[model samples]
Target: MQKEIQIAQLITALQKGDVTAFDQLYFEYAPLLYNRIFKLIKSPEIVEEILQEVFLKVWNMRAQLEVDRGLKTLLCRIADNLAIDHFRKASRDRALQEELWTSSVGFYLHTEESIFDKEKQRILNEAIQLLSPKRKEILTLCNIENKSYKEVASMLGISANTVSNLLVSAMKDIKNYIHSKYEGA
Candidate 1:
């Protein structure tokens, strides 16, 4: 009963912005609060940090202090809430980091495949370039542009049979060129 009266006086003094009373409150309650917080969070560093934050919150909100209830209860509640918040934030950060790592790995695989495809295209283009101009034009129109033999023959002023023969020869030459180059490598 006597201790309660002293604490009530401290609370009233604190509401009026008495620094000495606030110091007394800290000296009296901080250790108990620290132990309570440490039980929830096993790190000494985190416990110390949370203890300071709890006291800071109390000091900031001293004007609303309710002397009728236990001040220790209020302090413990604040410390517990802050510790839970810290754990929630840490969980969210860990999940976000894992998501980023997965995305980067997927991007790396896509990039590697894209590079390989570009190299193969370069090699095929080189082999096509080695053809005679007329053969290259015929093959490009028929295969690359998806034109029919008749369409290519009409565009190039040749017979459809001539276009077909030229395409067959062009395909054979391209296949031989690719096989020779890659086989040697």
Candidate 2:
């Protein structure tokens, strides 16, 4: 009960732009947040980054702090959200890498002996150019730039679902183009 009162006081002070109070709150809560984040992320480096981000968010949202709801709850919620974002990005990156690898392998295995590496690259580039501008940009962000659906959506100001659908469509079109170009080869 006493500790809760202290935390509440700190939160109240933080909301009033007290940097010292914020530092005190951080010192008291950072270890707990780090452990909670590490459970989800399992990487010290990334956990550290997310820990910093959580505090940064706390600072940014200081004015809106709800002291009655418990600071620990808010901190944990922010940490969890950041950790989930990391996982989502990592999962998307792995899937994209696998798709590119599979495409490259299939291209090599199915192409004729006369098709040199440069020619294969040229064919792939030609296929990419055939995409509509939006699809092309989506493909570049997802594959070439290695960005997550969320990142691409944020960049283009579109929904993540839209980014995902366009990427799937773009991949299919690229595959079809490559297949047709090498059908007899």
lDDT on C-alpha atoms for all candidate structures:
0.93, 0.93
- The candidate maximizing TM-score is 1
lDDT over C-alpha atoms for residue 130 of model 2: 99
The residue ranges of model 1 lying beyond 4 angstroms of the native Cα positions read 172-185
Q: How well does candidate 1 match the true structure in TM-score terms?
A: 0.85
Quote the RMSD, in angstroms, for model 1. 2.3
Tens digits of per-residue lDDT, candidate 1, 1-185, equal 99999999999999999999999999999889988988889999999999999999999999999989889889888999999998998899999999999999999999999998997888789889999999999999998899999999899999999999999999998999888878988
Residue 78 error, candidate 2, Å: 1.3
List runs of model 2 lying over 4 Å from the truth. 110-185
Error of 1 at 10 (Å): 1.4
